[model samples]
Target: MTLAVLSGVGVLAFAGFVYSGVYDVGADNAHTRPVLSLLQTMRERSIASRAEKLTLPPLHDPARIRQGAGNYNAMCTGCHLAPGVAETELSKGLYPTPPNLTREQVDPREAFWAIKHGIKASGMPAWGKSMKDDYIWNMVAFLQQLPSLDAAKYHEMVEKSGGHSHGGGESGAGHHHGGEPMEHDDADHADEAQEHSEHTEPASPSTVPEHGKPGHHH
Candidate 1:
């Protein structure tokens, strides 16, 4: 009987605390110390528990890491940042700031899970819906090696990767394509049509190279 009474009282007190309107929800200020600690503990524990059962892939492949570098720049750099990036507009505004991946050492499987399935209530977006698994893995692979690179090396790889500014392909399937999809398709079709036309045409005397072009001189 005593235990039941105590439980009822405790429940009421907890309910009163919640309904009291003393808790601040604004992002401008940090969470109260105890609440902050509680949240951190819960998030860490959950991630660790889930990661234990995961079998991680070999994340050291150069090709995948290069792919991941491009994806990260397109998708993640605004929040997590790359080497030599001092700050980002989002980094300042997010309440629990996103870590600078360039400086932070991330566990591969945990990073994969977080990238594929974003943390709840955090600013991170889930990439799995739009990206293929291979792409997600590539992002993880890039992150594993991010700490060692400088800004120049990071830029060089991303520039060469030819990934979408916002997502997977030139179509930018993961983000808005802004007419580029049809444009690209039309361009490809035009090239095909031109090739067909060229093959069927009789070569005009003036159009024939006659082996007189500079490279053809040999």
Candidate 2:
């Protein structure tokens, strides 16, 4: 009888909350501690549960790391914020703000799953629709090496990655936006990577966004 009475009260409380419209759904405001904790628990558990079955390939392969860095610089830099890169334009405003990839290294399987299938309602987009599985794994490989690298090391690796990047007219194959996809040869990529490498100064190690710092020079 007591359990039934408590159940009835719980139902009434839920109904009151739904009808009262007191919940704030705004991004600028964070959820209450309890609510935030609950959501975070759910997200982590869901990823762990889903990713447990997948086998992770060797993530330290140099070729794969090079390929991943290229793709990451082209696509993920704006939000995931590359090594030595401060919070980017998109990262500044994204709710739950994308985690700093350089410091908080994720498990390989979890990283792969998240990259292939983005977190719901986050700015992250599922790349499985447009990207190949190899490309996704390559990005994860780069991420595996990310935490140990400072700005100079990170820049040096990318610069020396031998024309693998698709950005800055280096490739015509991948997700190029707004520009015509004209096929370019290795010579073209080499020239562009060299040019891109020469003029660029490796930035200092960026401060992790402790309190929503804003500014993007990348």
Candidate 3:
């Protein structure tokens, strides 16, 4: 009886493999339902297996949350906007749109690991090599607080948090095409000039004149 069942299963598998000729390897075509379902299942299992051994640090402090917000805004907001924040034109067309990490559905530690290691074949790239471990941990700590964060407060925290600007690719799935680098260069030059002016000595005291007078004594 067992041999008969095995034989039947083998025959079914063979038939399915050959009859499912609709498999389009073209990038333009969306994955078939069965293929998509299988991929999703595999993705979940892969995440669970890899994340099982991850050790998360305690992330209870408000400061860490604030820092994480900075990282999120500069690195993540483009791909995964805040709850009330809307998506920009560039994010609309990515093959696998980025996830909204601010939602309660995501676990902080899991989010952190995902951000640090990134998912393979997915648009997400591992940040572990680029970002410091402390930064990754701070991001995890921040994710824990995202669900409770209001738009106003999230904006404030991000504005106040002092950190380096992250490249757009870190946000999630979308690609930041060229042209932005030119804008950045111009901004950088302006910033340098402003800094130089701020520290430079004031004009000669001789140029100072008496109040309410034009080259004349008061």
Candidate 4:
């Protein structure tokens, strides 16, 4: 009876605290040290627990890293700035500033999980939705080497990659993550589309519609 009464009192106190609106939710208003510490701990433990059992793939392939470079430059630079890039407006404005992955080394399993399944209320997107698992792993591969790259080497790798190409016909356009369209260079769109088309098997002549044939008249 005493334990039940204490639990009720604690619940009421928590409810009252929430109702009071004492904690500011504004981005400009930083969380108190204790609150920040608690959040950090929670996030870390949650990610670690989920990623603990993940089976890691080979993350040192040159081709994989190269592909990851282009994807990262096109998709992630705005939030997680590159080696040469000091900061971006989006990165700066976000309440929890996105990590500069260029200098930060992250555990590959945790990185893969985080990239695949974004953190709640954080600006990270679930790239797994539009990106194939292999592609996501490619990003992980690049991340392992990111901390060691200089600006020039980074740009070179990105240039060599098939820019902004998500395999299986998911183009950079029309894919919404966190309610925003994924952005890439207009010049690269033609190349990206071409790359995607190349991966797709062409329809056999027998399967082609009569009206859709090159010589067919309307």
Off by over 4 Å in 4: 169-218
Q: How many clashing pairs does model 1 include? A: 0
Cα deviation in Å at residue 129, candidate 4? 1.4
In model 1, which range of ten residues has the least summed lDDT?
202-211
Model 4, residue 11: C-alpha shift (Å): 0.7
**Cα-based TM-score, every candidate:** 0.74, 0.69, 0.63, 0.77
User: What tens-digit string does per-residue lDDT give for candidate 2 at 1-218?
Assistant: 69999999999999999899898868788889998898889989999999999988888889889767656655666677766677754678888889989888788899889888989987788877667777788889999898898877776666555433422333333322121221246665575556545644322212222222332122
Candidate 1, residue 121: how far the Cα is off, in Å: 1.0
Residue pairs with backbone atoms closer than 3 Å in model 3 (clashes) = none
Please give the TM-score that candidate 4 achieves against the real structure.
0.77
lDDT of 4 at 38: 92
Deviating ranges (above 4 Å) for candidate 2 = 1-9, 160-218
- Assess the local accuracy of residue 11 in candidate 3 as a C-alpha lDDT between 0 and 100: 100
Model 3, 108-196: lDDT tens digits are: 55676788888876667687867777778887787777778777766566655543323222321121211032122455557645643
Question: In candidate 2, which residue pairs clash?
Answer: none
The predictions' CA RMSDs to the true structure, in order, are 13.8, 9.2, 14.0, 11.1
- Of models 1 and 3, which has the larger TM-score? 1
- What's model 3's lDDT at 160? 58
Candidate 4 yields a Cα-based lDDT of: 0.72
Evaluated at residue 128, the lDDT of candidate 1 is 77
In terms of lDDT, which candidate is strongest? 4
What lDDT tens digits, residue by residue, belong to model 4 across residues 1-218?
A: 69999999999999999999998988877889998999989999999999998998888889988887767766777778776777755778898788989889999999999998988777788888888889999999999998999877876677676666567545534322121223346655575456546655311111101112243222
Model 1's C-alpha root-mean-square deviation from the true structure amounts to 13.8
TM accuracy, model 3:
0.63
